[model samples]
Target chain A: MSPHLLTLAEAAALIAARKLSPVELLEDCLARIAAVQPRLDAFIRMNVAEAEEAAREAEAEITRHGPRSPLHGIPVGLKDIIDLKGHPTTCHSKQRLDHMAEADAAVVARLRAAGAVFPGKLATHEFAIGGPAFDLPFPPARNPWNRAHHPGGSSSGSGAAVAARMVPAALGTDTGGSVRHPASHCGIVGLKPTYELVPRAGVFPLAFSLDHVGPLTRTVRDAALMLNVMADGGQDYTRGLTDGLRGLRIGYVRHFHEKDQPASAEMAAALDEAARLLAAEGAIVMDVTLPSLDEFSAVNRTILAAESSVVHEEWLKTRPQDYAAVTRRRLLPGLFLPAVDYMHAARRRTQLLARVNEVFADVDLLLTASSMDEAALIDDEPEVERTYPRQARTPFNVTGQPAITLMSGLSSKGLPLSLQLAAPAHAEALLLRAAHGYERAAPWKDYAPPC
Target chain B: MTDEEIAALVKAAGLEDTAARYPADVRAALAQLARHKGQLPRSSDPTLEPTPAYVAPRP
Candidate 1:
């Protein structure tokens, strides 16, 4: 297989055995990015000079002493919201295109220490809120499966790049499913680790309390490998990955899609098939219910708006014209929201966490819909608006649980169909084990987009 | 909410000079929040405190 086609783990194993060169892998990825970038528009900036330097250093160091980690010579893209020292963290907005990151974000620092190469900064929604917007400084990333469709955001470019094989993995921050949305839409593995499991210090703040940083990769084990390095103490995220789900109790929340939000016919069918596949692996799949998706959406949105508006208040008052129309509408409400409402949202968040905990007590993981439908036309404003919030992701963000979205199957159109698996806080090991098992059993295992 | 109410809130935030639809958007937002308010179970007991949002890392 081509170096660009290798998963992180595959590439790492080859590099360790001296069969692959770090420089060779980085060059292959760079070449793929060159070929598909114009069509996909997945990157906002390319850190070529720094990345080439890092790759060469990794190559020489590995030759001398051996690899530092699985990512020792791997090229990983950083979402533009993340601070990478000496690079401008544009957040894909015209407003702060000149804002250079003085220091690496905590996660970036950790990744750098692990010998990962910085491929560049990927596109994000404007300040991680406004999206696929023509009015922004850069054109939004298009879906790899079907270029005309949305790639999902606010982590748009991260998902697009990984799915298109431009990079093995990329980092994305999720406030309300930004990571998982693109993961679902792009047919990749996206994990939002338990809130605060990974550091968020230097990433641009969308909603501080709700914010999370995670990886989008081609495989579940790849997600775990990235997490193992991103978090401190070197916790082994891959330890349980190959352990088949013989007796794992997975609660399939059908109501989230079937009743609360009503996912598309194809998505609904794909979800059922995914549950059946899990059961076929000797797992017990039981129907479970939680607070309505609407309740979670409302609570999550209210808090996100209130907090994000505060982050951008000065900009709104001074340079509101710089923001896209969708971004403005999304941020405007928070400006005048009664302070008491934010408090209520926070209070309800506590109760919601408890509710999910109660469910987790009986089941090892919870399965639900990530997006009600796959990528709609990127240019269809009304359709985008309609499908944007028809998701089960915000509930977990509100509950601060670890959730992973992986491709369940392919739609008739060949676009990726997705399902979400979530666990109680800090149960990412369980999430990966189940997701990895299903990925191996499912028909779409390691399926590449026809970009 | 009435236009007047929306206007007062906008003017209070000093965003009255923004687009004409700004006030209307605020009204719709407030209405949405009102709908969400109905979902939150009211706690009469002062002891049901909200989380500080972050807790120390677990061992």
Candidate 2:
């Protein structure tokens, strides 16, 4: 198999056994990226020179000594919003076209220590907010499954790259389901670690309290391999990968899709089949209701608008024309949002977390619908706007819990369908366990976008 | 919000160009903001309902 097609874990194993060279894997990924990038538009900037040098060094070191870790020599893509020492973190925007980073983001530093290679900066929404936009410095990424469809964002490039087999792993930030959205729409695994689990010292801030850094990979096991290095003093997230969902109580958050927003009939059926599959494996599936999606939507949007406004206020005031029309439309409301409402949203966040905690006391995991529909045409702005908020991922962001979305099935349109899995705060291990278990039994678990 | 109120707010935020260029978007944003404010729990109502088990600080 082409090294580029290997999951991160499989590539790591081969690399450790001296059968696959880091240089070979990196070059293979680069070649595939060159081939697919024209259609997918998944990368903002290609830092090929440095990545090649690092891959060569990793190969020599591993040959002379031994592998440093599973990620040793693995070529991982960095989201454009991250500061990768000396690279322009364009954030797919014109505002930072000339901005250069003097130091690596903390996560980049950790990955460097783990000996991971970087191929380039992946595409993100403009400042991780506005995306698939025509006015940005670069074009929006398209879904690998269908080049004309949206790939999901603002981690659009990350998801597309992984699904297209251009790279094995990529990092993405989640504020309001950016990570999970792409994961869902891209037919891959997107894990938004608990808030603060992965430090955010160098990541561009969207919503201060809601921002989180996590990994997007092709499989749940690859995601585990990713978190082992991304977070500090992490647990053996892979230790429980084989611990299936037997006897585990999974609370089906049907209301989030069934009543709150009414997911598409296909997506709703996919989620139901996923729950049934898990129950067949001995998972105790039962209905669990939280507050309405609108309630969480209000709290999430209020905090996101107010906090993001603080980051873009000066620009909104002085350089409004520089922003994409979509970005401007999204950020302008924050300028008019009453400060009292922002605070009220924060207070409401606290209340929501308390309520979710009460629910967790009775269940080990929460399952819900993600994306609510399949990928839409990239140019269909109205459809994007309509399906964007019909997700269950934002509630976890508001509550600061760990959540992941993975492929549940496919739509009749040949687009990927997904279901979300969430756990209590700091319960990433359990979240991974349940996701891995579900993926193993899922009919679409091994499904990749036929790129 | 009235068009005049939105234009005035846009002008105050130094985004008069935005109001002129994307009036509908500005109006849409204002409408969504109003809807969000309505969904927020009233301060008088019970806001934080922590179960007796334990109430950890917000993650």
Best by TM-score: 1
Tens digit per residue, CA lDDT, model 1, A1-451: 8999999999999999999999999999999999999999999899888899999999999999999999999999999999999999988887898799899999999999999999899999998999879998899999999999999999999999999999999999999999999999999999999888899999999999899999999999899999999975668999978999889999999999999989999999999999999999999999998988877887788789889987988887777788887787788778877787787778877777778778988999998999999788999999998999899999888888889999987888888889999987787888999999999998686588888
Residue A386's lDDT in candidate 2: 86
The parts of candidate 2 lying over 4 Å away from their true place are: B11-25, B45-59
Candidate 1 local lDDT, residue A110: 94
Using DockQ as the measure, which candidate wins? Answer: 1
Q: DockQ each candidate and list the results.
A: 0.44, 0.34
List residue ranges in candidate 1 displaced over 4 A.
B19-46, B56-59
Restricting to chain A, the TM-score for each candidate equals 0.99, 0.99
Pairs of residues at least 3 apart in sequence or in different chains that clash in candidate 2: none
Cα lDDT tens digits, model 2, A1-451, are: 9999999999999999999999999999999999999989899799999999999999999999999999999999999999999888888888889899888999999999999999999999999999779988799998999988999998999999999999999999999999999999999999998878888988889988889999999999999999999986667899988989899999999999889999999999999999999999889999998999889888888889988998998887777778998998899899898888877787777778878989999999999998888988989999988878888888988888889999988899999999999998778888999998989987676777777
Clashing pairs in 1: none
Query: B1-59 in candidate 1: lDDT tens per residue?
Result: 66787678777887866745354555665676666667655556566767733552453
